[model samples]
Target: MIKNAIYLLFSFFIIGCVSTKSTLKNVDYKATKPKIEKGKYVITEYANDPKYGYNKEYPINIGFANLHSEEYFVKLFFNGLTNPEGDIFSYEKIETCCPFPSNHNKMGVGLLHKYRVTFNNGTTKDLYINLYEKGEILCPNGFKILAN
Candidate 1:
């Protein structure tokens, strides 16, 4: 039908807009996976740069290459973090944006996930995550790693 043709054309246009070179600044293929304890990642370091997860160009790259489910790793990352006051936080996946090149996917492109994190005091922050690339897992500057 004409509608299906139009939809296909639109899809191609959108895919054509994706940049061939990724803008991500913190992808580390050699980064090792973190230890999981009690269903959470045991993150031991804090990000030195404030933009680590807040900026779309520097997403928290929890690669899916070796993992079976993306949400599993995402949950582990958030469960390993807490507010600065040492209180557990809650998060929700708000959106998916920022497509970039990646060899991990059949399409050779990947999208970034945006999460809204809420603390016990009602404070909130947005974090960008890339499940297609790997990086050193660390707590973002404004947050703290959950105590073991």
Candidate 2:
């Protein structure tokens, strides 16, 4: 009986201290649109709640001129975006403004930046990038939005 009680206690302790990383495989995906600002692609279709501390990264806009490229999913069923030929810009790469973070961070929103993109075709273009603010998505490229 003592051994059984100890096992139960150990199980409870282990369970309490465990942290989990989530995978999106079981998540339901919905097709959504994106915005193109100064030759940069912005996925504004994502719905993030700031109340839950989900607004960690501020929007950083990276840009290049006359950018033309093909974008595809990094994996067959993954959450990353990549380009094999053209230029690729993602919302994940944004936000490098402020250092201090709190429940509210000024880093959550900031100014835009420009970048020069050299594509696989050896062509050069100027690009501009910015965060996709709520109700700020002007163009939609059919990006994917996952829902529970």
lDDT of 1 by residue, 15-111 (tens): 7978888899999999998999999999999999989999998999899744358778899999998899898888999998888988888767788
Clashes of each: 0, 16
lDDT string for model 2 (110-133, tens) is: 222333434445544333333222
Residue 30, model 2: lDDT of 37
Over the full model, what C-alpha lDDT does candidate 1 score relative to the true structure? 0.89
Model 1 quality (TM-score): 0.90
lDDT per model vs. reference: 0.89, 0.29
Residue 81 lDDT (model 2): 25
